[model samples]
Target: MTYILQLVTAGLAVGSVYALIAIGIVLIYKCSGVVNFAQGAFVMMGAYLTFAASRLGLPPVLAVTLALVLMAGIGVLAERVVLRPMLKAPVVAVMMVTLGMLIMIRASCLAVWGPDPLAFPRIFPDGALELFGVFITYNYLTAGVLSILLSLGFLGFYRFTAVGLMQRCAADNPRAALAIGIHTSNQVSLAWAMSAGLAGVGGTLLATLNGLSLGLADIGLIAFPVIVLGGLTSLGGALVAGLLLGLLQSFTDGLLSPMIEDLLRAHTRIYSVGALQQVVPYALLVAVLLLRPQGIFGRKGSERL
Candidate 1:
């Protein structure tokens, strides 16, 4: 039970990070109708910016704040400069542009920061908490708590706030919302800003847990399964799905991998499973795609011809 609890705690922590990124993806899809594949780049941007600030002797909190602010600016600039111009382009073309942006951002990071991973400065205070015979590090506790809180707060803002209502209105029908006096374009831009800012915080949290690295952008791939599982347009679904995926990963690492590897080695001559936890998310993605196209939280809707 203690072991299970430990895994669950770890899973929720990782899942919270996934949820943050997934929410950002859903928000962009909702508001702009353009999937920002470069969302992960914003994650990297935040971590790198934080790392840079730390190098300059800034405190962790201020560094993280600065990074998020810069990430928001980058989001706004991407909307105004890259997406807005080609707003009328084919969906595939726009998606390709986002992919191009991702590649460009990565290349730029490599050029500026080089390829080695940096030892991230500690953000959370050093310590551990023991509960019910499970030991939890302060980093994990803080990251998990912060991630879940931020996700919940964003959901609250989306559900109860005026700006949230406006974002929803624009997402429902941009043209109609514009006709009704809402600034649909501004909503789209704001979506980008909020999404990027969320991703920035997520990135900082992840870096504190796993160290800062260019490879942090690759976590976006993990998020693909999360949003797909949650429903591309469902923010709430993303949160749930992120937690689900995180649990699957944690269990796979803790139990399934060892069991399968041992069985294979004893009976079938296979030596290893080669990181089974990493495979779990994609396997779940495939299952979700085949079984529930609308996703667990998505609803079927009608459209007028």
Candidate 2:
């Protein structure tokens, strides 16, 4: 029971980070209709930026803040420079541009930070809290709590604030928004900025959990299965799917992998199931796509071109 609880706690922590990053992907998709493949790049950059700032003697909080602000600015700039110009281009072109942006960001990071993984500074205190036989570290708790808070806050903003209303209007119908005098272009840019900032936070939290590395960007790819499972247009779906994927991956990593390996070992020549956790999401994604393409909590016909 303790072991199961431990695994659950760990999964929740990691899953929260996935949910946060997934939300960013959904935000960009909803606002601009372009799938931003560079989200992983943004995540990678945030971790590196946090690392750089920490090395410069900034506290972890400050370092994270600096990274978030910088990433938000980068997102705004990206909208202006890349997305804005390509507004008239095909959706395929915008996607390709985002992919190209990912490569460029990765190359730049490699040139500056090199290809080595660095130990991220610990923002939370060491050791775990014992509660009813379950042990959870401060890091996990912090990540989970912060992810929830940020998600709820963003949801509230979308529901109440004027800017958020404008964003929703634009997302719901760009032509209607423009016809009604809402600055759809500016709203789109704001969406990019907000999405990038959220991605930065997601990246920073992930780094704290898994350490800083170029591979961090790959989290964006992992997010693809998550959003697909949750539905492309539903914010609530993203949150649920992110958490579900995270927990599924964690449980697979902790319990299922070993069990499968043991069964294979006894029956076959295979000695290991390398990175089984990574495969789970894609499998789930395929199943979701095949069975219910609308996704959990997603509306039918939401996949607009």
Candidate 3:
């Protein structure tokens, strides 16, 4: 029971990060009809920026705020300079541009930060807590709570504001939105900014949990499986799917991997499952594609968010 509780807490923490990133992905897809492959790079940049800010003697709150603000500016610049000009191009071409942007952003980070991992700044109080027999650290708890709140807050904003109404219109039909004086380009830019900012926050939480490193960029790919599972057009679905995936991965690692490994060891000579936890998302992805390609929350006839 203790072990199970531990996995649940840890899963929620990691899943929160996944949900945040996936939410960003969904936003871009909705607004621009183009997946910003650079979403992961934005996450990486956020963490690195935080580190740089800390080195510059900023406090945690200030550093994070500065990082997110800078990321938003970067997002706007990316849209205006790189993506805006390509608006008339094919969707695939625009996606490729984002891919290029991802490479460039990553290269810039590598050039600046070097390849070694950095110890992330301590944002929460030190020590751990035992909650009903489950142990959780202050860092994990803080990250989990903050991420969940941010995600829910974003949802509330998306669902209950006039800006959200405009956003929906822009996403539903950019051409029609433009004809109706909606400034779809501005909507697209706003989406990028919000997405990048959310990813920055998520990245900081993840770096606190997993340490800061270039490998953080790879963690961004985890959002793909999440969006696919939740339905490409459904932001709420992405949040749910991200948490579900985190739980799935946690159980796979904590329970299934050990049980399977024990069985294999007893019956044959096999000793490991080749990162079984890591494979669960793709495995689920295959099942999802075969059975429900539109995702659980995705509408069948329309691609509306």
lDDT of 1 by residue, 1-305 (tens): 99999999999999999999989989998888888899888888789989898889999989989988889889999999999999889999999999998999889989999999989998898989999999999999999999999999999999999999999999998888989899988999999999999999999999999998999998888998998888888999999999999999999999899999999999997899999999889988888777887778876541100
After the best TM-score superposition of candidate 2, give how far the Cα of residue 249 lies from its true spot, in angstroms: 0.7
What would you estimate as the lDDT of candidate 1? Answer: 0.90
Ranking by TM-score: 1, 2, 3
Residues forming the 10-long window of minimal summed lDDT in candidate 3:
296-305
Off by over 4 Å in 1: 301-305
Q: Candidate 2: where are CA atoms >4 Å away?
A: none
TM-score of 1: 0.97
Instruction: Give residue 216's error in model 1 in angstroms.
Output: 0.4
Local distance difference test, candidate 2: 0.90
TM-score between candidate 3 and the true structure: 0.96
Q: How many backbone clashes does candidate 2 have?
A: 0
lDDT of each: 0.90, 0.90, 0.89
User: Given candidate 3, what's the lDDT at residue 109?
Assistant: 94
* TM-scores of all candidate predictions against the true structure: 0.97, 0.97, 0.96
Candidate 3 residue 177 C-alpha distance from true site, Å: 2.7
